[model samples]
Target: MIQRIQTIYLLIASIVSGGLIFVFNLWKTLKEQIFVLDLFEEGLFTLNVVPFMFITSSILSLVTIFLYKNRKLQFVIGRIIILMNLFLLGLLIYLSLTLSGETIVSEKGIGMFLPILVVLLIVLANKAIKKDEDLVKSVDRLR
Candidate 1:
């Protein structure tokens, strides 16, 4: 079960979300690079929503990997991860627009694209899960 293709997809998704997160900068300012924590230096609670979502998505992907015994549930969780990534992508776009200022002259980072990749990975996992479910149903019909 652990050796299934969907497990590999989920593992890669988790690695992308959890591991690659820190390797890339979210965005850069004229004054400094990201991971600067300047957004939080002002002591605002509403900041850092993107990083939080990323961590949540990573955890969900990891959890989904272990639910191989329940294909239906695993498929549902995969859908949830897709929706989460979509939401994260939307939020990232919005924030980038706002952060660019009225002149729209800030550099966007590659990290923003991570959500799209995650969504793709989750969809592949869901597809594999569905295929597994269909196989099980076919075998049951044979009996």
Candidate 2:
């Protein structure tokens, strides 16, 4: 049961995060310019939600591995993993933004692949989450 709940949380977070990338891309297309790599350069973007997402995602991923091994509170652990992933992604976007001396870079040349990569990672994580859930259930049944 715990494993199942964790799996659900992972799936939900993955789906939401993946969906958001698409939505953000659409919004970017409609806008005149997009800020891609502001976080790495200016550091202002780091102050926003992006940094939290990166830190949380990294910690959660590591912690989830331990939790899974110990058969601990899987759901909470999974949520943390998902949140961490989201934050990492947010950070990636923030870092990808390019800026000039006093102006932000134009959006015309922004590559589409980075966002796609982020979505791909989320999808893969969701698949792994399902696999983990299955493994946990099998072990539970054996016990």
Candidate 3:
């Protein structure tokens, strides 16, 4: 149901991946320039994928939330979302580390860690979904 704990987690995950990304700066360049890392900015090679991945992750989470009647499918989608977030996290780490000592990126912003938070929330949602599935199976067995 919509009031389930996993639904709340998925909603938060969607908000973090979709909305909060625009609100926070990902990193600052050595030139004191800020990079928000949204879909519109088309400069860096690695960054181009960030926005796409974030949007995909957010969409996946939102879709998974509504698949509550099909717990197995929902769980699988959650796993895919986790993998996407992990890939995004890896890409962000690579970009930050590679650019840190360069003249382009001098400082990383708090938004750089937003994907990590998204991953954590998705995992929690998956766990709760699993628990619900188990509870359902147990009730079926009792009947």
Candidate 4:
């Protein structure tokens, strides 16, 4: 289970969703204050869901890594994570666009793009999991 290629992909996703957020700033304000999901000020109240989603996705990725015995469930969870990340990406984009022109938030950071990367990694992991599931089904049919 741990030896599977999906394990590696999930691990990387965990790092991106959990660890990288602290290191990467989400956006810069006019006062030169860099903000991350968790470090946002009071004015960023509307975007509070960002932190919760990131943490949830990170935890889900880790949980999926251990449920290697259930490939179908793992694949489903992967799909959930992908959708969550895509929603996060869209939210970030919409917020950035609405706040355009350096009024409050300006110059989006690399962190805004991290969801795309996580989505890609999760997709690859899901593909691998699906491949494993298909191989198992094929073997079971031989019996």
Top model by TM-score, which number? 4
Which residue runs does candidate 1 get wrong by more than 4 Å? Answer: 35-46, 100-104
Candidate 1 structure quality by residue, lDDT tens digits, 1-143 = 88899999999999888778777776877765564133445344435666677888899999999999999999999999899889989987887777644463567788879999999999999999999999999999999
TM-score of 2: 0.38
Weakest 10 consecutive residues, lDDT, candidate 4? Answer: 33-42
Per-residue CA lDDT of model 3 for 1-143, tens digit only, reads: 88999999999999999989877877776555454455357676677888889989999999988898999999999999989989998998887776644854377788789889999999999999999999999999999
What lDDT is reached at residue 109 by model 2?
A: 33
Q: Every model's Cα RMSD, please? A: 2.2, 9.0, 2.1, 2.0
- CA lDDT of each candidate? 0.82, 0.45, 0.86, 0.88
- For lDDT, candidate 2 versus 3, the one ahead is 3
Q: Per-residue alpha-carbon lDDT of model 4 for 1-143, expressed as tens digits?
A: 99999999999999999989988888877666455555444456657888888889999999999999999999999999999999999988887777645655466788999899999999999999999999999999999
TM-score of model 3 relative to the true fold? 0.89
lDDT: which candidate is best?
4
Question: Can you give the lDDT of residue 115 in candidate 2?
Answer: 34
Q: Give me the displacement of residue 93 in model 1, in angstroms.
A: 0.1
Residue 28 in model 3: lDDT: 72
Ten contiguous residues minimizing lDDT sum, candidate 2: 21-30
Clashes of each: 0, 10, 0, 0
* TM-score for each of the candidates: 0.90, 0.38, 0.89, 0.90
Ranking by TM-score: 4, 1, 3, 2
